[model samples]
Target chain A: MHSIDFIVLFGTLLAIALYGTWKTRKSHDLKGYLLGDNSMKWGTIGLSVMATQASAITFLSTPGQAYQDGMGFVQFYFGMPIAMIILSAVVVPLYFKLKVYTAYEFLEQRFDLKSRALAAFLFLVSRGLAAGITIYAPAIILTAILNWDINITILIIGVLVIIYTVSGGTKAVAETQKQQMVVIMAGMFVAFVVLLVKLPDHIGFKESLVVAGKMGKMNVIDWKFDPTNRYNIWSGLTAALFLFLAYFGTDQSQVQRYLSGKSIKEIRLGLLFNGVFKIPMQFSILLIGVLVFIFYQFTMPPIFFNKTETDKLATSKYEQQYNELSKQHQQVFDQKRVLLGELVAADKAGDEESTTQLTERVNKLQEQQESIKAEAVGLMQDINPDLDSKDSDYVFITFVMKYLPHGIIGLLMAVIFSAAMSSTSSELNALGSTTVIDFYKRMVNDSATDAHYLFMSRLFTVFWGILALLFAVFATQLDNLIQAVNILGSVFYGPILGIFIVAFGVKYVKANAVFVATVISEGIIVWLYFLSRAGKLGITYLWFNPIGALLVVAIAVVLQAVWPKKTT
Target chain B: MLKNDSFMDFLKTPEYTEAPVLGNWKAFYLTSIIFFVVELLLFSYLTIAY
Candidate 1:
C-alpha cells in the first residue's frame, strides 16, 4: 500500500479507538462499565448491534463467497428479521424489566443457578472462539497486504481491541462501533461504486447483471427442502431462524448491545433497525462480490488468488507444473472473455438463440477454468500439506489492492480493521460481563464491592482478549473462516437457545429437568456434527439450532414427567 | 432507572402504547416485514431474470 493508504488505515482505526476511549473514560462502576450507563439512543444501539454482527469476515470473505457460490448465501439471513422482531417484542422487555447485566442472569431467575451457568458457559465457549476468528479475519488481510507474519497481525488487532475494551468496557465498544459502522458502510459503498465503474465501458450495470446471471452467480434463493443444502430457503427459515433467536435472544454479545439502550422502546427500535437494514446490507456486500467476479471476467484473475501460497509454489520444484496450469487458466479466461462479450451483446439485443448458445460456451469455459484452478490448488497442497488451499477469501482484498485508487484502498483497509475492532471489542465486552456477572460474581464472590467488581470486569476483558488472541494465533486449520465461525455458533447456540425456550415457553419443566436436558441436547448436537462431518448424517449445520433447542424442550418435558418434584 | 418488575409483570406491561419514533410498534413491525417481502421479491426477480 502507498503512504496515503497507511495514513487512511491507521488514521481511521486509531481515531475511532481514541474517540471511544475518551468518550467513555469516566466509566468506573459496574453498571457504567457493563451496561454503558443505560444511556444509548436507538440509533447508537442499532449501529452497534449491526457493527458487532457484521465483523471483518463479513466485509472480507462474503464477496468471495458470492464470487464462488453465488448470492444464495443471502438466504442464510432470511430468519434474522423474524428473530429480531421476536426479540424486540418478547426478549428485550424481559431483560429490561429484570434489569439484568447479562442474558444468563435471566436464566437464573427462570430456572436455577446451574442452568444460568450452563448457558453462560455455552456462550463463553462459542463467542470466545468467534472472537478469535473476528481477530483472525482481519489478520488475514494485513498478512496478505504487508506480507507480515499472521501471528503478528493477530497480535496487532488483539492488542488494539483489548486496550479500548478493557479501558472503557461496553460504553467504549458501543461508541466506537457507531463510528466504525459509518466507516465500514461508507468504504463498502465506495468500493461498490468503484466496481461498477471498473467494469468494461461497454457493459452497463443491467447488462453486467445479465452476464452474472447467465453465469449462475445471481442465484439468490432455492426452495429445496433438503437438509443437506446449507443455504436453501427451508434451512434458512428454520435452522437459521433458531440460530438468530439464540444469537439475539441469548448470546450476550447481541443481547448486551440492545440492553444498553435508554429504554425498552430504544432497545426494540434498535433491534427493528437491524432487522430492516441487515439483509439489504448483506445483499449489497454480496453484490459487490458479484461485481468483482464480473470485473475479473474482462480482466484475468490469478490462477489462484492466494499469492502467499502461489509465490512459494512459483519458486518450488512444482514451478513448472504451476506454470502449465497458469497457461491453461489463461487460455480458459481468454475463451470465456470472448464468449462473455458475445453473451452480453446477444442478451442486450434480446436474441434468445445466440444468448443461450454463448452462455453455454461460457459455462463450459468456466468449468475448464475451475478444473485448472483445482490442479493448481492441489499442487500447493502437495507443496505444503498444512496450507489452506481455498483462495476465495483472498478475492476481495486482492481486487482492492490491485484495482482501487490509493486513498480508497486505505479507507477499505480501515473499514476492515474497523470491523475487526468493532466485533472484537463487543465480544470481549460481552465476555467480560458474562464472566463476571454470571460466573465470577455469582460463583466466586457475590458480596464484592462495586469498585472490586468494576476491576474484575476490566480484568476479565483483558483475560478473554488474551484468550481470543491465543486461539486466533493457533486457529489456522479452519475452513472458510466465515462458515467456521457460524458452525461453531450453531453447534452451541441450539442448546443455549433451547434452555431459554424452555425457561420462557415450557414453564412446567423445572431447573433440574432443563439442566439434564441441556446436557443431553448438547451431547446429541455434538454427535450429530461429528456424524455429518464423517458423511453419516446429511443434515446441514444450521439445522442444529432448532434440533438442539427442540431436543432440550422435549427431553426436559419427559424428564419433568418422570422425576419427582422436590420443594426447595 | 432499574425496573424491578417480575417476568410476569413485564408481560403485563404494555410494550407498545406507541413507538418512540414510528407511529406504533405494529406499524414498525409491519414496515419491517414489508421491507423483507420486497427484498425477497426483488431477489426472486433477479434469480428468474438472470
Candidate 2:
C-alpha cells in the first residue's frame, strides 16, 4: 500500500507489458499472430506452459492449503511428470506433422467436421469461464487483505493482460511470461528465505521442521487408496493422470503454448522441462507454508486469517462471545508455544519417550486453539449467512501483508499480478485463436484474406477478455476458487480427451459413434458430479476424468458394433 | 485402413531428433522417469523422517 510498493508493482508490470508489445509489434500474418511465427525455443515454450498452468491461485492459495491441510496436496501433481512424458513422446510429433493451428483441427481430419466443432465448443465453454476465476481469485484475496477496491483490482489485472495479448498475440503472451516467471520464482524464493530468517534464534531450521512434523504439518505423501479421499497416491497417479493428459494434450491454452515451438524437438523438450521441474517448484512453495506455520508457533497468528470476517464480528451481537473465544485462543497459543519448545528439545536430545508425551500435550493445546477459532467462524456465518467460511485462501496473503517488508510487499504483489497476467493472456490468446481458426475460418468465412483473419483473431481476443472481466465481477458466490476451477475442468476435460484418444487409437470407431458417445458421456459425467456433490455418490472429482473418458470409449465401441457405419 | 494412416506408420516416420544434452530421446525420457522416481522417494522420506 505504500507509494514505494505501488511504484515497484506498476513499474514491473508496465515494463514487461510494453516490452512484449513492442517486441512483437510487427506481427501481421495469421500464422505469425496465432502461433508466434513458430519462433519460440524450448525454454520459452516450457516457461510459457508452466505460467499458463500456475495461475494467481497457485501462488496465492497453495501455501494456504499447506497451512491448513499439510503437504498431502502435493500428491495432486504426482501424475504431472508422467503426463508430460507421454505428451512429449506421443502427442507432440503427431501435432507437428499435422501442422494444425488448434488441437481440434486434427480431430476434423481424423473424424469429421461435427466432431471437431464439439471438441472446440467444449474447450471454449470450460476455459472461457475459468479465465474469469484466474483473474478474480487473486483480485478478491489481494483486495481483501490490502484494503483496495475490488472492481479497480479486477480491471487492473484484466485490462493489462488484454493489452499485451491483443497487441502481440501468442508471441507477446510467451515473451511476457518469460519475465513473469522470473519475477514469480524470485519473489517466492525471497519470501522463503525471509520466512527462515524470521524464525526465533533458538529454533533453527531443523527444530522448525521437527515442530511442524510433530504438529502434523509435514504430511507430504498419503499412500492410502481410499477413493473418496481427494489427496492420495492412488488418486494422484491414476485419476490425476487423466486430468493432466486432458489438460496438456487436448486443451487449447496448453496446446498453443507448445504449438508455438520451433520444431517437434523444441516442443518435446519444452514439455519434458516442465515434467522434470514442476514437482520441485510445488514442493518449495509448500515448504514455505510449513515454515510459516512454525514461525506462528513462536508468534501469535490472527485468531482467524480472514480479518474481513472478524472485522464484521467486532460489531455483531455476539461480540462478547467472540472476545471470550479470542482470549481463550491466545491462552491456548501461549500454552502450546511452551510445550512445542519442550517437544523440540526432547527430540533434539534423543529422548523419544519425553518427546512423545510433549507432542501429545502440544497437539491437544493446538486443538483447543482450533476449536475457539471454529466457534468464531460459526459466529461469522451466523452474522452473514452467505459468507464463504473457508479462510485458508487468506492465510498466505495475510502473512505477506503483515510480516513482509514494504518493498518486498510490492514485489510479491507484482508476483501475483504477473501470474494473473501471464495466465489470462494465454487464455485470451488461445480463446481468440480457437474462435478464429476452429469456428470462424472453418464455418463463417472460409475465403477471407490473411489480413482479415489476423484482424479477427485480435478482435476475438479482446472479446473474450471483456467477457472474462464481466464474469469475474459476478463470480462472488464460489467456494474455494481453486477447487471450483478444477472441478469445472474435470467435468469437461474427460470427454474431450476421450474424443482425441479415439481419434488417435481407435481406427474402427467412426465419427458418428464417437460424437454421439461423447455427448452421452458428458451428460453422464455432469450428472455424476452433481450426485457426488449431493453425497449420493462417494466418488472424488479426480475420478471424473478417467470415468468420462472410458465411458466415451466404451459407448463408442458398443455403438460402432451395434450400428456399423457403411464405407462409402 | 490405409498404411500411411495407421498410428504405427506415424511412429515409424523418424521425425523426432536428438534430445538436448541427453543425445538420445529414449535416454532423455528414461532420465526424466528416473528423476520422478527419486522425487517420490524423497517425498516419502519427508513423510517418514520428519
Candidate 3:
C-alpha cells in the first residue's frame, strides 16, 4: 500500500475510535456502560446491529464465496426477515417490559439462576470464539496480501477495538459502529463500481451479467428439497429461521445492540430495518464477486489467488511441475476466451442454438482448467500440509491490491479493519456485560454499588479482548474462518435458543427441568455434529439449531411432568 | 356489537402499542411481512430472468 492508503486507513479508523471515546467519556454507571443509558434511536441501533453482524469476514469472505460458489448463498438469509419479525413481535416487548440489562436477565426472571447461567455460558463460549474469528479473518487475508505479520495484524485490530470498548463500553461500540458501517458500505460500493469500470470495453454490464448467468453464477434460488443441501430455499427458511432467531433474539452481542434503544418501538424499527436491508446488502456483495468472476473471463486471473503459498511452491522443488500446469491453464484460458467472444456475438445476434453449444463447450473447458488447478493445489499440499490451499477467500483482496487506485486501496483496507473492529468491539462489550451482569453481579456481589459494577464491566471488556486476541492467534489452524464462526454458533445457538424458547413459550416447564434438558440437548447436539463430521450422519449443521431447540422444549416438558420439583 | 367490541379489545391488548411510523403494532408487522414477500418475489424473478 502507498502512503496515501496508510494515511486514509489509519486516519479514518482513529478518528472513529477517538470520536466514540470522547462522546461517551462520562458514562460511569452500569446502565450506561452496558446499555448505553438506554437512549439510542432506531437509526443508530439499526446501523450498529448491521455493523456488528457484518464483521470483517462478511466483507472479505462473502465475495470470495460468490466468486467460487455462485449467488445461491443469498438464500441462506431468506429466514432473516422472518426471524426479525418474530423477534420484534414477541421478544422485543418482553425485554422492554422486564427492563433487563441483558437477555439472560429475562431468562433468570422467567426460569431460574441455573437456566440463565447456562444460556449465558453457551453465548460466552460461542461468541467468544467467534470474536477471535472476526479478528483472524481479516488478519489472515491482510497478512497474505500485504506480507504483514499475522500476529501483528491480530494485535493491531484487537488492541484498537479494546481501547474504545473498554473506555466507553456499549455506547462506544454502538456509536463507532455507525461510522464503521458507513465506511464499510462505501468501500464495497466503490469496489463494485471499479470492477465494472475495469471490465473490458467489449463487455458492458448487461453482457457481463449474461456471461456470468450462462456460467451458472446467477443461480440465486434453489427450490429442490434436500435436507443436506446447505443453501436451498427449504433450509434457508427452516433451519436458518431457527438459527437467525437464536442469533438476533438470544445472542447477547445482537440483543445488546437493540436493548440500548430508547424504547420497544425504536428497537423493533431497528430490527425490522435490518431485516429489510440485510438481504439486498448481502446480494450486492455477492453480485460484486460474480462481476469479478465475469471480469476474469476477459482478463486472465492468477492460477491460485493465494500468492504467498503459490510463491512458496514456485521456490520449492515443484517449480517445474507448477510451470507445466500453468502453461496448460493458459491454453485452456485462451480457448475459453475465443469461445467467449463467439458466444457473446452469438448472444447479441439472438442465435439461441450457437449460444447453447458455445456455453456447454466453454463450461467443459472451465472444468478442464479446474482439474489442473486442483492438481497444483494437491502438489502444494504435498509440499506443506499445514498451508491453507483454499484460495477463494483471497480472490477479492488480490483483485483490490493489484487493480484499485492507491487511495481507494487504503480506503478498502480501512473498510476491512473497520468491519473487524466494529464486530470485535461489540463482542467484547457483550462478553463483559454478560460476565458482569449474569455471573459477577448476580452471584459474587449482588449488593455492589453502580461504580463498582461499572469498574468491573470495563475490566471484563479488557479481559475478554485479551482472550479474543489469544484465540485469534490460534485460529490460523482452522480452515475457512467464516464457516468456522458460523459452525461454532450453530453448535451452541440451538440449545441456548431452546432455553429461551422454553422460558417464553413453555410456561409449565420449570427451571430445573429445562436446565437438565438443556445440558442433555447440548450434549446430543455436539455428538450429532461430530457424527456428521465423521460421515456417520447425513444431517447438516443448520438443522442443529432447530433440532437442538425442539429437543430441549420436548424433553423439558416431559421432565417437568415426571421429575420432582425442587425449591431453590 | 358485543363481538365487535371484544375484537377491538383484542386488538388493544396491553402488550400492543404504537409503532414508530405505522399506525399500530399489527400494521407494522403486516408491513414487514409484505416487505418479506416482495423480496422473495424479486429474488425469484432474478433467478428466472437471468
Candidate 4:
C-alpha cells in the first residue's frame, strides 16, 4: 500500500469519529444518550439502520458469495420489504406508544418481569458475542489482504468505535454512521464503475451479463421449494420473514436505530427506506462479484483466493503436489478462455448450436478448474487444520488490492473500516442502553438520577467495547468461530421472536404460561439444531426461525389453554 | 402513553390507520409492496432471458 493510501484511510476514519464525538459531546441526559434525544430525522435513522446491519463482512463475503454461487443469494432478502412494512405499520407505533428505551421493556409491560428478563438476557448473550465478530471478521480479512498485524487492525477498529461511541453515545453512533454510509456506498460505486471500465472492450454491460448468464451466474430467483435449500423463493419469503421480524422487530440493535428517530413518522419512513433499497444494494454488490468472475475469466485468477495460505504451501511437504495442481489449473483456465471467446462469438452471432457446444466445453473446463481449486484447499487444510479453507471472504479485498489504484485502495479500505466501526458502535450503544434500561435500571436501581444513569450508560458502553475488543483479539486463534457465532444468533433469534409473537399476537396466553413455554421451546430448538448438525434432519438453518417461533406460540397457547387464569 | 390494548385494538389505532406524511398507511405499505414486486419481476426477467 502507498503512503498516500495510509494517509487517506486514517484521515477518513479519524475525521468521522472525531466529528461524531465533537457533535454530540453535550448529550448528557439518559434519553439523549440512549435515544439521541429523539432528534434524528428519517434519513439519518434510515442510514444508521442500514449501517448497523451491513457489517464489514457483508461487503467482503457477499460479492465472493455471488462469484461462487451466483445471484440466487439475493433471494435471501426477499422478505425484508414486507418485514419493514409490518414493523412500520404495527411494531413501530407500539414502541412509540410505550415510550420504551429498549424493546425488552415492552415485554415487561405485556407479560411480566421474568419474560422481559429472559428476552433481554438472550439478546445480551447473542449480540454481545456478535459485537466482537463485527470487529474481528473485517480485521482478519483486512490484515490478510494488507499484510497488517491482526491485533493492530482489531484494536484500530474496536478502539476507534469505542472512542466515539463512548464519548457521544447513540447520537454519535447515528451521526458517524451517516458519514460511514457515504464512504461505504461511494467506495462500492467507484469499485463497480472501475470493474465495468476494466472489462474487455468487446464486452459491454449487456455482453457481460450474457457471459455471466451463460455461466449460470445470473440465476437470481430459485422457484424450487426444497426445505434444505438455504436460499429460494419459499425459504426467502417464509423463513427469512420470521428472521427479519425477530431481527428488526425484537432485536435491540435495530430497534435502537429507529427508536432514535425524531418522531414515529420518521421511524416508519426510515424503516421503509431500508425496505425499498436493501435488495438493490445487495444486488449491486453481488453484481460486482459476477463482474469479478468475468474479469478472472479473461485474466487467470489465483488457484486460491487466500494467497497467504497458498504461499505457505510452496515451502511445506506438499510443494510438489501443489505445483502440479497449479499447472493443471492454468491448463484448464487456458482451455476455458479459448472456449469463452467462441461462446461470446456464438452469442453475438446468434449461433444457437455453436453457442450450446461452446458453453458445454467452457462449463466442463470450469468444473475441472473448481475441482483443482478444491484440492488446493484440501492441501492447505492438511498443512494446518485450524485454518479456515473457505476463501470467499478474501476475494473482494484481493481484487481491490491487485486491481484498484493507490488512493482508491485506501478509500475502499476506509469503506471497510468504516463498516466495521459503524456496526460495532451500534452494537456497543445498544448493548449499553439495554444493560442500563432493561436490566440495571429496572432490576438493580430504578430511582437513580438522570445524570447517574447517563454516567453508568457511558461506563457500560466502555465496558462492552473493551469486552468486544478482548473477544476480537482472542477470536483470531479459533477456527470457524464466526459461523459458530452466527449459528448461536440463529438458535436464539427464533425463540426470542417466538416470545414477541406470543406477546403481540397471542394475548390469551399470559406471562407464566408463555415463560414456561419459551424455556421448553428453546430446549427443543437446541435439540433440533444438534439433530440437523448430526444429519438427522434435512432442514436449513433459516427454517429454524419459523419452527422455533411457531413452537413457542404453539406451546404457550396449549399451556395457556390447560392452565387456569388468575382471578385478578 | 402506556396503554395495554389487545393486538386487534393496536392495529385499529390512528398510528396504523394513517401514515403521518403519506396520509394513508395502507397505501404507503402497498406502494412498498408494489415496488418489491416490480423488482422481483425485473430480476425474474433477467434470469429467464439471460
Best by DockQ: 4
RMSD of each: 2.8, 2.6, 4.4, 2.0
- Strongest candidate by TM-score: 4
Evaluate residue A501 in candidate 3 and report its C-alpha lDDT on the 0 to 100 scale. 89
Q: Of the true interface contacts, what fraction does each candidate have?
A: 0.52, 0.48, 0.38, 0.54
From the highest DockQ down, the ranking of the candidates is 4, 1, 2, 3
Runs in model 2 lying further than 4 Å from the true structure: A477-487, A566-568, B1-23
Residues A1-568, model 4: lDDT tens digits: 9998999899999999999999998997989999899999999998999999999989999999988989999999999998999888768877876688999999877777888999999889889989998888888888877888999999999888999998999999999999999999999999999999888888778888998998999999999999999989989999999999999999999999998898888898899999999999999999999999999898889999988899999789999999999999999999988888888889999999999988888888999999999999899999888778788889989999999999999999998899899999999999999999988999899998999999999999999999899889998666477667877887998888999888877777888888898899899988999899999999988999999999999998888888757510
What DockQ does every candidate get? Answer: 0.39, 0.38, 0.22, 0.45
Q: Which stretches of candidate 1 lie over 4 Å from their true place?
A: A476-488, A564-568, B1-23
Q: How many pairs of residues collide in each model? A: 0, 0, 0, 0
| List of clashing residue pairs for candidate 1 | none
* lDDT tens digits, residue span A4-110, model 1: 99899888888888898899999989999999999999999999999989888888889999999989999999998989888887677677877899999988787
Residue pairs that clash (backbone atoms under 3 angstroms), model 4: none
Interface RMSD per candidate (angstroms): 4.9, 5.0, 10.2, 3.8
Best by lDDT: 4
Q: What is the lDDT of residue B18 in candidate 3?
A: 40
lDDT tens readout by residue for model 3, A184-271: 9899999999999998887888888788888888889999978778998999999999999998999999999999999988999899
